[model samples]
Target: MQIGSIQLAPGAALAPMAGFTDAACRRMAARHGAVYTVSEMVSAKALTFGDKKSAQLIANGETLAPYGVQLFGAEPETMERAAALIGGYAFDFIDINMGCPAPKITAGGAGSRLLLEPERCGAIVAAVVKESGGRPVTVKMRTGWDAQHITAAEAAKACEAAGAAAIAVHGRTREQMYTPGTVDPAAIAAVKAAVKVPVVANGDIESAQDALDLLEATGCDGVMVGRAALGDPWLFGEIRAALAGQPLPPRPTLRQKMEALRTQIYEMCEEKGEWTAMPQARSQALYYMKGLKGAAALRRACCELQHFEDVDRLIEKVYAAGNR
Candidate 1:
């Protein structure tokens, strides 16, 4: 699939999930076979003001290419400045965040709130594209603000008109949040039909079959995997295999999962120091241990540890449990 001139191999993409799609996670996902991965959303206003943390979030990872950076804000000037600054960096694409439903973001007139202001959304896209200097500009958005306002089709058209290289549609309204239900495939297909650019479908794609079903239902160019990628970076490889008409590989054993977790934590420690990385690994460690027989005990033990060595030891203990 091609977003603008950027060609992405068929299969899975790592959705830009907050707190989970950091540099370490992106590198791991890429290494495990994700064709593309996006950085966590950064604040456009903060980036324009030179916020160090926001700038740091957009830093390039050595092993992760086709790096996409997502930025959020209401003001066109702020979005434009952010696009200009990021254009000078080593990013592969710039994505405007129009899908975030967080109240704080909406209260600030940003994120999914842009759905209500299509004209301003178009202007912001135009400003970012102009400042991008030919770098591909993409938009991630929701179905609408609510059931009464299904604006994704219109927003997709507006984004395409404003020069968006691609669009990712999450088939749920801001009010739906993350509820469990059937995604609106018609809404996604409508957006795909409304746009000239490639459209990527997102939402509830947790398995290889789910990916295939979404692609078929929406007639989308690609699928982005979010929560499902959480302890399972190998999901991308599985999706890739499925798309190639190959047999799916066997699921990893608990021992293998623990080993992967250990390797991930060690690599993160090497990159960010034990002090910083150990704490960051807590949630991921829980994710890795999720389905194990004694997972609750293991998660508690791992989460209580303050050092990499402790994490390694806990993983070793878990691995000793065998297939049970």
Candidate 2:
């Protein structure tokens, strides 16, 4: 799938998760075969207001090419101004976030709430596209506001007509809120059928088989992995290999996984300083402990982490628990 000049071979991307898909996590996914990665969502209104934290979110710190910064807002003028402000950055494109289902985001009439008004969705897309510095403008959106609406097909068509270079459909309504087992691939398929632009399917894809299943179900040009890539960024490589009809790569050993996790955490510390990054690392560490024996105890340790030494101590406990 090619968006403008960006060639996303294998059609795999790292979805723009609010706090999780930061620069460090994005770099890890890129190294493992994610062809595209978007920065965490930034508030268009905040950027327009000169919010320092919002400015920091779109910082071009990662070395990966074809990177993008995602922005969210209800007002077309605010989104247009925000896109123009970040035009100096080295982003290949600007992605409009219309899929976030968080209460705070939806309450502001942005994110998935935009799905309720397809015309407004088109206006917002057109506004951003007009100021995108000649770069392609893309959109990430949900199936609809709720099951009763199911308006993804209509919204996607509006976005395409308004100059969205591509579209990513998360296969659930705002009401689902990432609930387990609620993904509706049929909704994603609807969006794919409605848009001429490249369409990417997202939601509930954890394994290579899940990725293949979504592709078959939606006929989407790409798959975007979110939470599953937190500790296991290598899932992208596995999906890529599966799509290429090649043997899957061997799963990393426990020690290798630990090293990978360390790389991710340490990079975060370097980028944002230990003080600010460690608190976030607590949840990130828990993602790595998923499905392991004594995970309950490991998660307890993860929650108390406060510094690099704490992470080191936790690693020792993990090794002991794994009998490695």
Candidate 3:
């Protein structure tokens, strides 16, 4: 699939997930086969104010080409200014985030709240595009504010008309907020039909078949994997194989899974010191334990991780559990 001039060979991309799709994670996804990857959302307002942390989030030294920097904010001028500032950075495109359903984001009238005003959504996209140094600008958004306000089609049209290169629709209203089993492919199909730009579908895709089914159901250009890919970067390889009519690769063995987790943790440690990365590694480690035997106990151990030696010890315990 192609977004503007950027050609993505695989039909899958990694979704921008805050606190999750940092450099280490994006690099892992790329190594596995995600055709495109986006950085965690960076606040446009914060970047304009010289927020170093938000600025740091846009760094993509570890991820491969076709990577995008995602920016979130409600103000058009601020987003425009942020785009200008980002012109010096290396990225394939600019992604505007309007799908985040977190209360802190919505409370500030950004994220999913932008869906409440279709015109404002168009304005923001246009503003960013104008200052994007000729780079394509994309938008990620939800179906709407709520079931009663299913406005994805209308909003998508407005964005496309205002120079958006592509649109990614998370198939749930803001009210749904990641609730399982609530993905509305019909809403995504409407957006695809309403716009000429490529549209990517996201939500509840946990397996390769799920990715294929969503593409068929919504007629979207591609699929974006989110939380499901947290501990399983290989999911991208599976999706790529499925997309290309190739046999799926064997699932990672328990030892292999443990090694991948450790590699990711050490990479995180390299980027942010072990002390800082270990605390965050706690949750990441738990994701790798999903579906393991004695998962509850393993998770308890994962939560206590505070140092590199602790991770090695946990790996030993996980192996002792004989999880397949």
Candidate 4:
């Protein structure tokens, strides 16, 4: 699959999850087999104003090739400026985040709130595309702001008309934020039917089967995995296998899981320092430790962990126990 100048492998793509799909996590996902990864959503206004932190979010950090940088904003001018600025960065494409369900974003008439104004969304996409310097621009959006406003098909048409190369649709409206099993595959299907550009299905795809099911049901060209990838980057390879009609890959061995966990920890620390990275590292560790022997105790231990040295010793014990 191609997005502008970059060619993506045919498989699962990593969702641009804030606070999670950072550089370190994207690198891990790329190594494990994601076709492409998107950086966490950077604020367009911040980028326009030259916010160093937000601009830094687009910098390459061992992320695999074919990566995009996602941006969120309500204004066309700011979004266009941000897109133009990032065109010179290391990203392969530019993604507009019209799907984030967070209240802080939607309340400001950004994110999924863009669903309430399809024309304006199109204008924003058009301006960004024009300013993107011929880079492929994409859009990620939910079905609508709420059940009462199911506009994904309309939005998809708008995005395409405005020059988006591809659009990804999440199955839920903002009203169903993060609710399990609420994703409407029909909505994604409708979007695929409405647009000539490639459409990607995104929602609660947690397994290889989920990805295959989505592709079959929606006829989407791609699938974007979100929360399911927490500490489970290998899901992309498994999804690729399922799509190719191959047997599901084996689950990670105890040692392999431990090693992956350690690598994520060290990478997080390396990128964000030990002090600030620990809190989220603890959360990620719990996901890796899920369903393991003595997981309850181990989760509690991780929750209480404050120091990397302490975490290493505890992980060693957990690894030894699981091996036994």
* Candidate 1 weakest lDDT stretch, 10 residues: 315-324
- In model 4, how large is the Cα lDDT of residue 36? 83
Q: Report the alpha-carbon TM-score of model 3 versus the true structure.
A: 0.97
Winner on TM-score (3 vs 4):
3
Considering only N, C-alpha and C atoms within 3 Å, which residue pairs clash in candidate 2? none
Q: Candidate 1's C-alpha lDDT?
A: 0.86
Candidate 1's TM-score: 0.95
lDDT of 1 by residue, 173-245 (tens): 8988888994788889999998889999999998999999999999999999998888898888899999889
- What does each candidate score in C-alpha RMSD? 1.6, 1.1, 1.1, 1.6
Against the true structure, what is each candidate's TM-score? 0.95, 0.97, 0.97, 0.95
Candidate 3 least-lDDT 10 residues: 56-65
Give the distance in Å from residue 238's predicted Cα in candidate 3 to where it truly belongs. 0.9
- The residue-by-residue lDDT of candidate 4 on 187-301, one tens digit each, is 9999999988888899889999989889999999999998888878889889988888899899877777778888888887887788878887888888887777887778887
Candidate 4: pairs in clash: none
lDDT of 1 at 42: 97
For candidate 2, report its TM-score: 0.97
Clashing pairs in 1: none
The candidate maximizing lDDT is 3
Better of 3 and 4 by lDDT: 3
